[model samples]
Target chain A: MPGALHRVLFVDLARHRSWVEDRADLYSESLGGAGVAIELLREHCPERCDPLAPENPIVLAVGPLTSLYPLASKTVAMFKSPLTGNLGESHCGGRSAMALRLAGYGAMVIMDRSPTPVYLSVDAGGVRFRDARTLWGMSSSLTAGRVMLEREGGAGHRTVLRIGPAGENLVTYAGVTVETYRHFGRLGMGAVMGSKHLKGIVIAGNGDLPVADRGAYQRTYRDLYTRAVRSPAMRKYYELGTPENLGPLSAMGALPVRNLQATGYGTEPPLEGEALAREHLGRRLACSHCPTACIHLAALREPHPEAPYFYKTTFVSYDYEPLYALGTMLGVEQPEDALRLLDVVEHLGLDAMSAGVALAWATEAFERGLLDEKALGGLRPAWGDARVYATMLECIARRAGPLYTLLGEGVDAAAAEYGGDSYALAFGGLEMPGYHTGPGAHLTHLTGARHSHLDSAGYAFDQEDMKAGQSRSPKELARALLTEEARRQVLSSLVVCFFARGLYDADTCVACLSAVEKERNWDDLMALGEDILRRKHAFKAREGFEFDALRIPARTLEVPTPLGGLSENTLREAISEVERLLASGERFSHG
Target chain B: MGKRLRVVDVERCVDCLLCAFACARRFGGGGLAKSAIAVRSVGGMERGFVVVVCRACEDPPCLAVCPVGAIRKVEVGVRVDADRCIGCSMCVEACAIGAVQWDAVERKPVICVHCGLCAQYCPHSVLAHEEV
Candidate 1:
């Protein structure tokens, strides 16, 4: 069906030209989002291509379920990662998915570098190149976005994506900020865009989507909406947001603190979620088509320096990951200190997890005499020092000095250049997300496709084991993680938020896909899941990902976790089992 | 007496776009193309959102500008007779609040019928069906 979607928009930055190609098969067979994006990456990204080269293509895709169903609010971006030098896949939610879908395209492929700074304005009218020379070198991405918003013409649904000094300087962990709060946060998508001389993107459209079965569409949409809005399971997301995980994870002693030197801070660590909500909860936000406004903003009011009776209020969006990474992981106890560091990260357009981990590593290295005052340019790297951390972040974004330049390459590369590879706290070049549940968690990081905690959510597996009062064998744990990760491919393809995993199970997925696309069944989706997983693995393998060589961060093994002492051997065994299952090519059994 | 959709509190809006979808679904189609209500960020989302919908003027400025005599006042608001509408979009420009959403495909105004489907689906209760 060559409907409103399935038209892939290819934009060449060098020539300032854009063309459309109909790839109905890609959209239909793979569905959209991750499924289609992986295919685009494999087809477009050349082997051993420098990740920041103009030849590296950036593909952005929205699933068929997007704009039609609640919680199906993500847009998947695929490119070669500058940090990992591998396939980069990141999901961002906000106005991005809705704006892209309504703009009348299933996916967009951007190739080559522009001659000069430019931001692409996309709509039904097609891509228009706008000069962004002045907008370039802005202190903050927010400034660039604000300028773009004023210059935009389309009056319909809109989303603005821009990168800051970090991306412009080609910081490997720099992220492209989406409509403010949200982002394509992981893997270095921003650096690729930056290398292309692309400043930002302004997308606006409101094209109508034709419903294949009007009756089915209404029923499915309503069912999902009601489930999302009224479900008790979803309440925590909107009320306190993901920050609520802080107290519990700390209690479990699974929370990474002081750069994984220890797990969990004391019960009343100053940056607890409840205290933040009560004190500085500014506002709540929801991505388009998402009922749960899970994005929580902290209203930080700070007195302006050298200006008496004057203040500036900044709304810094925080989640469990950033709170842990920038807050407790750095031994940052004050709300002001954590929020201040986050505020700096947001403006610099750097990935919070990567930036925080970089600082944590620097502080630990300095303390252990691996780094010194001379190496830091006469600066002290201390835990919880937001002022110094903020300065370091600035230096990293600007690539100002030798040490700052190394830190910008990500901790794995940084540690490899300096000492401290054992405590680098990175898996597959991407910084570890805030989780230290057990061996399953470490195994997830080591063996998962992107090394993202969200890839397999092995933490949840560990939590489930703890609940069961017994730890599964390494092989059993590996199989469970593999199954969960494979199943997630279908959900990510549908582009549903992982938070709604329970509500949008196999049956819900089948109904939603059937209503929007062709008639779908559980078995078809299960088959698609395995295919998607295999395709992603194939891309990683072609990019030279070696399971045998994947490092299990020694720091994780040293720390006792919620599920007790986890060992490197257990992680190695689980990794081997995961490798076996991945190679078996057997159909994942459906429920 | 008739029901009217009112913004109970604009601040309560999460900008979920659920109300807009519900408005579009009222026409048995998908997308915001058919919705008579719009929610857009006020400057950036950090500030807040403005929900644009018909205030249902007592005199009805939209009714005065319909050159084809397509629009008429209902108990709560105005409704456009699609058959007679020339799609001149005079009514679209006439509504001060810009609530008369234009159906770019059909070339007509999708004025709210005050059925309150949008209000019913608003998770935040930003909108309410009020008695008039």
Candidate 2:
């Protein structure tokens, strides 16, 4: 921790001044990423600060393992969510972490608000606040990023983070786009950036970093690279990417179709992974240090309507989540329709999961006669109609009318305002991710931090139980889920991509950390992980989060899961057990 | 036979920068500042990447342009001598493909010696050390 990993950069946007501080002690204890970010969030953010207010600080942190190890590619972003209004934490895997680390800093904190639109230009010359007035109000995040990329002038070793019109319009579920296709895609981090009158952040640097043992570092790096390329654990992602889940999940009767109305596709699901790969998969991409290259892009070729013999080609990024949210969840029958809708959301800078669930609610509400053409701005809400959904996304991003504005607040707020709570499909104020596995998946969403399915991966656990033909008590299930979640804290704190969790096991994690820093061992790393989780919960509790007050939507209980009909009482009991376990963990007090 | 670094497939490059990392590690450190190899996207990575490195030109413009005659042609590529170099950066401008990457900290041009250390770590086989 002698070099960039020991320092923290702080930028006060309101004051238009910045400074760097050596926080070696903090980095030594927290080990960076979510661990360091949570401590910084507590120190900089006030207890009752409005999530969208200028006083709410944004913390971007990278871990010690980043840039030195393979698949240690994620940067942890901590902010008070404009969507959830609690702990807003999202991890992005792109050039974000690599660029920040190469720029010679372990972490960066953006505080206060700028009076006018601006972007922070970080380079070897250090931090400079650049005027972004002309770049503001761009049609898409890609355009804004391009404008900044040309002006800033760091082509190969740089990362440009920008938001599109949805974020500029203050859509509560908007996300920040990184590179062009990857994103810090959940929990309204983009809206928080918009509230500060910030348009983008440009990072560029190429400084050398120190290691505890150079020989050991090289050995560990080579071992990791070999495993990443040769391991069977990564073969699935290497072959078809995460979209490989589509076939298996659909076959298991766990894929949620048309807003959880049905678990299976019935006769013929129009959009299967194999078919998409055969017909449309144009390219494969990866994060900075990852070799798996799981990110897939679809090539959509269409003829120009106005002219003959003219064709237009568009590349759209696709993943299991977007395919589940925009494709199956919206009752989209054509793969082309799903890709078109995905392109619209990417252009508008909206979180596809939230946008899809909100649209699904609106479609159901329209069918119930609750939403009329006047409310919809003359557009009709119908399933499998890609054109109508595309227009609706534009309207929501622009906040075209009162009804559209409500939809911008996410499905939870929209449902509360328009009276559709029973089937709104949001857990703990955040839109649900794509999963209909069993009670474990549902319980994970309700109890996990950030309301993310990856927080615990209970769906995987549910499948294991079914395979074994064994049923565990609710307490047993809760313990198993929480234990795995607690262990994941170690991985995320190391800032490694969760996709490589199978490769970066506990022994490997300890070896990697020890290779970078001599002070940290296995016990110290485990203690740091547990402490980070506890501190996150403490931040939530201070922000007025109530564990017992969460409500399970009636549709969640109504749907027959793969394990059969799940009663409400079982989910409630699981939640109670999670609460008990969280309360019993060692307490944390701010220094 | 001597080793020569080769970009076997530009399409196979995922822009992971693992090869660049391996190049930097040759200096007994970590970072992109000292690496002699660089990978860049063609506008967008959707098309592919262009791996820029010293391809060992037979004529060698870098050797012709060096004022102090610090740069010399090697078996597979060019090598820069820090003692005789003036840090004028003429060699950087002379190279057509911008393969003569500079070491920003030392203000000297970093020409690859064709060590093939980078090719050893390239997981995708995008880079290889083949016999000339």
Candidate fnat values, all? 0.78, 0.72
Q: List per-prediction Cα lDDT, in the order shown.
A: 0.88, 0.86
Q: For model 2, what TM-score is found for chain B?
A: 0.96
lDDT score, residue A407, model 2? 93
lDDT of 2 by residue, B52-96 (tens): 998889999999999999998777777788999999999999999
Cα lDDT tens digits for candidate 2, A1-591: 324786788999998888888988888778889889999999999997999999899999999898888899999999998888899999998799999998888899999999999998986566889998997888888888988888988633888888899988899989999988898889998898998888899998677777888888888888888888999989888777787787777777788887788786744566777788999999888899788888888999989989999999899988888888898888997989999998888888999999998998899988888888999999998888989999999999999999999999988888888887888998888888888888899888888888899888989898998899887788888888877777778888888999999998877887787777764566666666666777888888899888888878888889888888788888888888878877887422111
Q: Model 2 Cα displacement at A255 (Å)?
A: 1.4
lDDT of 1 by residue, A431-460 (tens): 988899988788888877888999889888
Candidate with maximal lDDT? 1
